[model samples]
Target: MRNLEFKEKMHEYSIWRANLVQAIEMYQQWLTRYGMDDAHRTNTLLNILSSLKNDRITLAFVAEFSRGKTELINAMFFAESGVRLLPSSPGRTTMSPTEIFYDAEGGSYIRLLNIESRLEDMSLAEFKNIPERWTQLELNCDSPTQMQNAFKELIATKKVDRELADRLGLWNEREAATQGVMNPDTVEIPCWRHALISFPHPLLKEGLSIIDTPGLNALGTEPELTLNMLPSAQAIIFLLAADTGVTKSDLEIWMNHINRARSAKKQGLAVVMNKIDAMWDDLGGSNDYDRSIKSQIKASATILKIDEESIFPVSAKQALLAKIKSDKELLAKSRISALENYLSNDILRDKRNIMASIVMRDIGSLINESVNTANTALSHASEQLEEFRKVDFHNQDMTGKLMAETRDRQSLYMANVENFQSSRRVFIVQAKMLINSLAEERINEVIYAAKHDISKSLTTIGMKQNIRKLFDDLRDLLQDSVDITNETRRLVKAIHKKFKDEYGFKEIEPILFDIKKYQLELEEVFEEGEAFRTSAKVTMTEQGIVVDKLYSTLVAKAKVILGRAHDDAISWSNGALSPLARQIKDHKKQIEGRLQMLRKINESKGTVAENIAHLEAELVPLKRQREELAIMIKSMQLEGQLAESS
Candidate 1:
């Protein structure tokens, strides 16, 4: 278990997740066993299971070129391979945004999207679904040399004429000017826009994925890396060379992408002062070396406006060599174990908590509902049994009275159903309005018009104005969606109150559909867009590149948010009135069964003892299910406490 903290934690995380999935499966079976499963609940549980099964703990590594970012990844996850699994040589190794994870369905391979794919109007997400366009390469996992050689393709570059390079957004005019190149016939561009590697590594198999982003140029070129990919990651490791501390480009990246809002701390963001081995001086003695390291940490903390503890000074090169050779002393000197500890305890734990919350929110509530239903059924069954024992089978008057009461309750149930149907009809019309307000087509229309305005505009100011207008329109649309949702909620409340007050249906509060979340997300995008619109880089970069980047990153991200909002609206529309309806239906069933039993007894066709026996039999499984549900809730509640104690 030497140098294996992160690996062990990941293994534990995977097992815990599997247990949660199993609990959901058991609940699904219980729902079916009790005849409580419906199409809506069934679909929701399936979606929850699918999400948990495919969950990944993603950590994105962001750094400028030659900061040993790739090497740090190698030392952390791939050191066990006894080689640098990802090519981490001196040059800009990760020219494209590369994602590495285990492929559950396929063999080890690298899927590279051609740089020319950027010319298409489609976003990177749209391109991912059409896999045929990516060039795929198989990796021989058994051969380290072969894998290393194959991975070099990530850094592969091709010489393209200046026109083509400019067209691809690779040729930076200011950079060219600084290098004193007046006119060059040709320039180099990365061969791929993105790389996806599916390797059968242990941690990856346990659902750990890594995103290694290239230098500033790559970040500037690809808006998806900032908008969709990095934001989605649970953690981000921003790398800096210990010798150079935060360089000018590093500051630019931090301000624009990494720590723009300084809220990255909440997302397991950490700064790695890599290549600290350079500061390991033999003549300086341990005390002097410690002071120098401490001073550098302080300086970096001040410059980055981050806590001192957030930065980890590590020698990734030494760590890799130390782990491969099993040199404990070298490993200790590298301070790699501290970073490993952070990953195992801080970052991974936070991710685990987030996923746990999702499971509880979705499955936990359903389990609670089922348990309550089971309890109610058992209680009713017990009452029936007790009353059956006390009933005089020979007395016609007693049986007749019970039969009349049952019929009266049955009448109430029928009236409740009719009223619900009417209310649902009205709600259905309102739900359509809510859904249409958040429709993809609606947002897409605005995006299309805004994109047109930006494309046709000749000035940067015009483009900025158009982009700002797009956000304003989106905000207005989202506000309309929220208003519609509130109206729908109010309607649902009135319906629930009618049933509860008139028909004696149990009070069930409705869940609010969250259009506000999307509104907040759109606001974040608006802020980021505003920052980009005002930044010097926007003016310096080519107009075409800026337009494409904005669409690919910010606009694309907004579209995704709107799409999800619409989907949520649909789900809410379907499930809103279902709880009250189910309650009414179950109540009717109870009454009808009681009525049938009383009629049988009054006719002398069935005995009171026989009815009691049937009720007792029905109560057994209900009690067992209640106990099982209690166990699941307890386990979920104790997860974090147990992990922390361990």
Candidate 2:
């Protein structure tokens, strides 16, 4: 797996981020010197800087047990270890969700939260915030033996009392019977609820995080994984065995977690058909290996109802063995290179563009505001200075005329500022109302209610009808979001018209408000939801798998689907009004500039000239700063375009 492109892209983002921070810092200092410190604006800039500093691209691996998922990760990322770094034997090794990344500030350590912590009813995120709640083990990267020993903690299991197991929902008599662990007095569970491993891998050090999640049972119990981590991930790799194809349990995981949690727009989803080495080749040169792999890929794609191209046939074991032995021929046959190319070219490229869009949206707006403020202040100061120099003390009549005209002109300017103020207020109230209608809390409530209604409706009969109604309700909610976005766009156009035509406000552009893209995504999800319900009916007819299991899977999958919808809705609504928000801020700054002009005009006659001269002198540096910022923004955009093309 080559990460040359990924590394270069990240480096570019780092440079752009640093430059933006420098600009913001300089602007903040300039504001402080001018006695115009705005805490809200400073905090906003600081928050952006913080986000840039902590940005990470997450690649999440998910699958049913024994699909060689960890083997693939070790091959693609840990080839330098010269052996398998993660346990990937025949049975379940990763019993809980494990995250691997380099914690540059915290140094190397393995942090584990005890399984008993789950009983406390606190989330994994909350548990993480309190370091005292975790067990931390320092890691030594210099010693391979120590690193291997430390990693064994990921596989550690403990015997739990039957009563505790039952309370923790780990003991299901019927499921245990199916697994052939019948009539157990005690159950074995992972000692840790989750694991965080920090090491000095090249990718990890470069802000790449990998999440290794266990099978269905583990995911079914972790609400934080389903609700937070998975959805926030940039990409999700669903691993399946090529020999067995998509089993009932694999379908459960896919429907319940992988497909439902991934964003529809980003669509950062891939299927790795692992264990391709198991497909036997015919002795008579019939090309059976390729044909068998192709057949399995087609079957799995149809079963999952996803694009055929997204399914990759790979031999994880062969890939790892080939890498360790430095066998180039075997490595080529492993097909891991194709998957790596997909990640570097598709996933990382998309991430770069997304990061660029955000940087342009926030940092670009900031720089633009600084330029507008500086220009307004500079222009006012220059005009006042020129007028002051024109004042003739030798001629009292000329001075009187000049003073009267300046007062009249100031009155007109003040009236324009007042109108701008009132319009800005109107715009703010309208924007707030529009934004609140699509609030995250409100959308989450709608999703939860739909999930609740659908889950309650999933019985043996009339299940289809109830599920359809639930989808209809969701469709209506999505339409409501669309309506809100459209209304906001309309109101923004009105505001722009009033400011540009009535008040001569410069640089007014209509905000881009399009929830139609997100609406379509929701529509696609609705279709998928319908397919899920239909698939459940089909599963009910299949032997060995019970209807209750199908129903439970449907409920879990529906909840995740609804949750992703809420996330997209909130993101769309918030992003839709960002431009308008910037414009509103610009209007506020313009008003402040006018007020400053009025104050200067009302100052003592002697100091007004000095103040104007000082303000004029400040303009040269401010203009230079604005010019430099504009060049930096253009360069960043160009680099983003190049990265996208590459």
Candidate 3:
């Protein structure tokens, strides 16, 4: 069974996700009905839902050997099995950085990467590409005893000659001297480089992933863990033994890896002083135990340079025993709830905020803009419909006056057509000029510059920093493409101003050919490029492949991107002018028909009722469209409000 607190958190999260899904569906329907193109926004929403479907919140545990990190995991998530579900014996068990999560598609199994495979000069990521290189073993998760026995592989070690150990970066001469083994012939090393375990557990099934990492030595060997996985996790729980607080290796792990990974975002770090039960007192006063624990917490906080409140003192063994035996007093004494509360309240709340921000920024803005645009058009249509209804068709003087106005309208209509032609020619010239400025040649210039920068970086020792600088240059160049966008925008405004001020066309909205869409896409591409370059475990040969792949893909896509921009510029220029020109012609035709009707009524020669009826019939659908549009706008507005409140 899951803890009550986590179950509550899951319930709230599910509700939030369900509401977001509903809003997305409603927006999609609105777009389809209105014939609006929202391919980018719709795709973004789908990706969000897909991520939510696999919504895993990872909590990583980092500690040196036997700091009770494994025991904490067993106590918090696996105590229901009535045994330490993972190997948490007295000696070291977690040799490699182990990731445990429920993989419904992968089945119940353990996958291990052999240490000898490192001799291939391949990174872990490259090793993953060749699945035949790994050792796979099936596990019977249904049997606790079987799982216990299977997990003993974590503690399995091998004896290697001192020279082989040193070559593998496993031997420490100073440590050997301290242990009085200065002339040792052999050294111990972990058998595997990494371990992956997949099983069905309540918390794991609920999208909870746990990363159990070994001490500083193992972390030093795997750069990806420090660079990628640890930073990506929602929370990193660094465990320390209360009996032996702040060891040299613990301080090294904190200062180098864990702290560095979360330097940019400090929300993920948490320290746990585990095995507090080891400080129990029988002969001393009750206050002595409290004072001792407080001293340890203070000492740890001072050493770690972290807030005192961030340290949580807990007894995992007592917590596990208390929960299994239903001992509430012992559970309270264990102080496990303090850490669980932080996870449930603070960490999970931050995750929810992040998810909510994505919804607001992407989907919420999309819905708001669409609804506002529809409302504006509907208002214009309603006002025009009212003006049409007021046209009399019976008054003789009014008919004569309207006939004169129709003739005048014809002249105005010709002027509008001429203005449209003149404006379109000017706008098209400017748009094509802007498009030419943002042409493939310009893009290639930037691409070549980036290529040159990246080439220089490839030979640098600080590969990660160089990769970042490469992407920084790429982002700056991509942003330069927006200059063309700014020019095009100014031209569009000038064209819209001509139509509105000269012809009094207030119903038309600005033609929006958004260059930011392309800008955002490029941003995503660069972010992924950075991730692959900096964190991916690619060998030198694979690094060359990565660079070539990026160059080819980016250059090819750049052509298509600029080509689409050119096409959209031309299309928008044409489309924006055509509507107002059509409206002018239609108004002229309506006036001409009214003039003909008035002539008949004034001469008292024919019935004008049929003409009036025809005009009225045309308005019926316009009114209906306005009504439907109003309903959709209201619904979308309500959705936005609800999302904000959520």
Candidate 4:
């Protein structure tokens, strides 16, 4: 099959490879001739060249506490192995970074940073009996089974006897007696405080690495892990409990962190509504299981402002069991099959296809071919120029021509950065406008409508209940509004914090300040109306409840009026405040553009500087080579002339 796209990419990669090879060869030749063999310099250049050619894809799993991050991972990959990478209990499992890489020869190996090897071989069961030195060791095994066995032996539950605990420095009688409880922090665990499990799984072998992160506190405490590793991830999957829906913490994470860090390329985010099984019991008579799921999905979708399709409601426990048993029916029933399909089929394969088609096939081949052609011409010209250098070359005609060509090519490459920067600015402005329109306008309208509609429903129910009960109900309804408003404020604060911290801008603060001012305005608007008071004598009658109909009607009317005002406030805030956000975003983009430009300029300048140095170094040798060639040619011509004269 003559695939033109593939052929083109291959061609580009080939040219890049050839140019890199040629560069290496030229450097080596220069070093050899000058007797300047600097191994360190050569190695650095080689590493830079190699990194340009190799690329890899990564997928990461992340979430808040009790979100089943580890369980979801187990369901996906470790089902057959029956080994949990992270602790699944109520307590925290992952205290530090644990990487699981595929080791073909060694089977599995745990590499510890500062730990000793002697303590690594002990089984998990024996861990409680071992001294502090045991937890310091790095453990590595060939098989998952072997690793699990070792772990079990090392953390031997049976070995948690008083003597063993005392010897291992886990038991403190005085502290325990006074405290009335064991201190988890002070207790020594046999398992490496940081565990790394590497095995040959089909998925992992295929370059699918899942990082099961610790709780929110741990993630926050470890900045390097989130800042470095999380950003590098090609895809991130966040899990939330289906029963709880999107909690305050979940919303905080989304608004503060994940949403801000998202990019169009190499960044995919998915939310898994895990533990769907829990919702099956609490659902009311009118709430069908599917309907309940849909409602939860809708609620979550509203909170996250994401498509319903993006949130996959699943049972991690059932999924794990199904995968372990290889039961397709169970997998399908658990709804985890959708997640599996998304990951294996949509995410992994889709990314590979795109990479193959775009980067590897098109850009790689094109750049490679262009570079190879340029290098071949440059190399040939250099050789020819050496010969012409000795004869004075009729006023340096040959050297002048070659220098002009090099300058022309370099200039063309330099212009592309400006073009890219201009296009990026335009795209960002449009994108910001679209985002503000949806987030501020559409969302505000929906929330306002919902609030008023709920208030109206409360008013209608007041006709049946006594005045006291009606007042209590109104209070409850108002409390719900207060709760929602508080939640929104919390979300806004989270967003504000992230914006200030990451981008060094106070973008959300102005919007939130506006919101607070608007809320006060709304309260003032409502206070102007008559307020309802509860009374004990107001009992229900057959005709109708003796509730304050006028007050109830006024409250409902106030909700509708204030709801519109709230929405208008949101609109005004968006209109007035969004420009600031956009400006910040624009400035950020500009900064990025400038940084990219600086990088390119630096790279180009570095290349040029290196080339100049190489040329300067070779000048003497090239002159000598030209001189030698000139002498030989002259001698040959003279000998021929003499022979003819004789």
Residue-wise C-alpha lDDT for candidate 1, range 54-144, written one tens digit per residue = 9999999999999999999988888888998788987668889999999889779999999998887788888878989999999998898
lDDT of 2 by residue, 353-460 (tens): 787667665445444555566566567556655765665434557655655665665565667656656756765665566556556566667656655564565454
Q: Report lDDT (CA) for all predictions.
A: 0.83, 0.69, 0.71, 0.48
The local distance difference test score of model 3 is 0.71
Clash count for candidate 1 is 0
**Model 1 TM-score, all chains together:** 0.95
Residue runs of model 3 more than 4 Å from their true location after superposition: 119-133, 160-168, 181-186, 393-646
The residue-by-residue lDDT of candidate 3 on 1-646, one tens digit each, is: 2356775785676566666566566556656675553455556557666766777789999999889899899888888888888888888778888999989988888889987654444566566677688788889978988988888887779988887776555677777889888878888888988888889886677678999998888876565577557877999999999999999999989987888667646696789999999999898766999999999999999999888999999999899888888888989989999888888888888887777665565455455545444554455445544554576656666666767876887788788878777877876776676666566676667667766666656453454555566567556655665676677677777777777887776545554567787676556456545555654333333444445545444334444556666665555544545445545655565556556645654665445556455545655654554566446435433445534533
Off by over 4 Å in 4: 1-56, 82-86, 89-92, 103-107, 112-146, 149-194, 263-266, 282-287, 349-646
Runs in model 1 lying further than 4 Å from the true structure = 261-265, 604-611, 631-646
Best by lDDT: 1
Cα lDDT tens digits for candidate 4, 1-646: 1112222333444454445445544544544463333443344345444543443346667778777777777776667665654355454444444555564554654443322221233322234244453333234434555555444422222224554444333355665777786544344433333344556655455444556565453343333344445655767788888889888868766754465335333237778999887777553642577788899999999988888999988888778777777777777667876666566445555554544333232123222322332333345446533543342323345445544554554454344344334534643454344334334344445444544443444443453233334334434444444455554445445544644665344233333322344344334323322122222212221111122222323334334444554554343333322323443434444344334433343345355445344444544654554444334324222224322322
Clashing residue pairs in candidate 3 (N, C-alpha, C atoms within 3 angstroms): none
Question: What TM-score, computed on C-alpha atoms, does each candidate reach?
Answer: 0.95, 0.72, 0.69, 0.42
- Count residue pairs with overlapping backbones in model 4: 30
